[model samples]
Target: MVHNYVMRLNNLQRKIREEELDAYLVTAQDSIYYLTGATYDTAERPFFVVIYPDSPPDLVVPELERARMKKAQGIRVVQSYFDYPAAPGGNWYDKINALVGGISKLGVEPSIPAEISSKLWARDIVTYSLVSELRLIKTDDEIESIRQVARYADKGMALLVKNMYNGVSAVELLALSRQLQKEIVKAGDYDPLDNEFITVGRPAPQSAQPCSVPDYGDRLRRGPLSLVCTLRLAGYAAECARTVFLGPPSGSDAELFHHMETAREIAFSMIKPGTPCAEIDQATRDYFESQGLSEYILHRTGHGFGVGSHEAPWLSAGSKDVLEKNMVISIEPALYLRDTGGFRHSDTVLVTEDGYEPLTTYPATLAALTLKDRRPLKSLKGGFVRRAAGA
Candidate 1:
């Protein structure tokens, strides 16, 4: 009752009916959960959601998940089969075909199991890859769930800031973030980590940015100015980094951090409904130019975040999608020097009828707590992060 899987079916049905499709094969884990409330992750034994727009959503799961699928209340029909480990003679494709036959138009997530999809294609059928566009704007429930995740993120960021000072390594801070309270993130029954996700950096040198395992080293120190972007909690990735001064930002460090924060402010200020994503990007770049820090603008403004950390409706140099209500995003226009480090302001934002809602409220603003006092790293609640309303 809490999660109306029927709503997803309703929307998908409208699309399918318009195109006169019989069924849509959904292989993506998120898509399955969004449509059936039945989630499982066993790549060896494939599971899929075969949604018949006209009828109820059916699930094709393995024998092991049969009882669980049968007990599931949302999905009305479910078909179980023996999978890869011992499904030699069993033809699961045939079952899939039976459900998909006559469905002239089939919709699938962009990232599907290539092998399975290739064999499942029909000559007379229209297979649509509705990803970025389909997920462009989130529903009210989706928005609320993400907002809940942001609450934990905001709390986590606050904890991180409280411990900010000399001698704290990036690795330590990263570890500390993992140790903060994850109450709000897990509150809505959405498990983001166990779900398909990603967390990486956009380091000064792009190569070091996306490394799954980075030798955080002494990359964070009391010098230059560094920004620490971390994916701290579930269902959300806090892609914000700061301009830390080696021993309290001063001179060039202070100057750079100030300009970078302004750049981010410029971008955040431009976040309104109907604004072009690319134009928002240009606004940030222009701020950097105004400060004569163009060369330090390392990455494309920012990107979309949801079930996957990096998604569509990206805020890049040439994106064309207009910002819309309930579309959550993070705008981190930054400037970083090679060994010196960087400065960035990133908040998980929800686009509103007016401006945007900042999910995390660490308040890394230049004037807020640039060179604040630092006590020893204290034990934070929930071991991961805290709640953030807005800042």
Candidate 2:
């Protein structure tokens, strides 16, 4: 999709004028990508986009990346420094100072590293999240891009579910994820660097730890297995996750899953324009509390996602953000049992005028997610036919 970077820049410039700032400095990699569509490794070296009130944006990069920065959208002035820790006059700091020497008030993102912000040569270095605030409301192209990525996320989740068996290991899942990444790159004709596909498989007790990474040799067993698929395409991201039973779920497991789904739906029903983010989270929390399962809650209900997997408009109790139309977010209300497993399903949702629309279309019903002890021949044949047909 072709993005109107000129219009985005104009919006930022307009915001800059409103704040009475001469220029705004963007140092975050994702923020820079949101503005200029430039992607690069940001190891140690400082990369910046300087936006003036009247003229076009200026980019500062390492000399090695000069050619690529020159090709970036909405950028006309490309300045480069020799390298990190270069001679007194040939460093990033010097280059930035030269560009903003005449400006009295400079705007910088609040998340900028203190080391860099401290050395900037502005008399008034204001902290502002202009780009982040702008990103909260996505444009038409961005919403379309996110929808496309969500489709791949659903496909990846289905592939993982299809490959599940008695003793599948996380390493095997990783290999499958890489294969899926290749398929998406070929099918969508996207740059390999711009696409990321990751799948995490946690079975039974291990799944209780939401943030722990499964060992390479960890294998799936006969219990609740949490499968997480996160995909990024063309700088947009979507996530799909489900807890499937390797065998027939126990009564307690089914009960927990039902409660989790109920809580998720309650939150979903509350999503709409002008709804306070905290209210949605509180309603979910209230449901879990009523079920006496509040102790199992480990994280917030959800958060917004686009260029960055987790952005603003967070669905947490303390968040002041409000739901708005065109904003894309995830709805994941989970319950983690100590020795059992996690019960959760996450879907990327778009807030609309009336309610919300789920972008990820993977099946989330318990009956659909339950797996047999062995892979069915019919399932294998179906997968083969689908692959043969180039689906």
The TM-scores of all predictions, comma-separated, are 0.80, 0.94
Residue-by-residue lDDT tens digits, candidate 2, 61-133: 9999999777678897899999998999999999999998678999999899998897888888999989989
**In model 2, what is the error at residue 189, expressed in angstroms?**
4.0
Off by over 4 Å in 2: 375-391
For TM-score, the strongest prediction is 2
User: CA lDDT, every prediction?
Assistant: 0.62, 0.87
lDDT of 1 by residue, 230-256 (tens): 453333344444444434555776787
TM-score of 1: 0.80
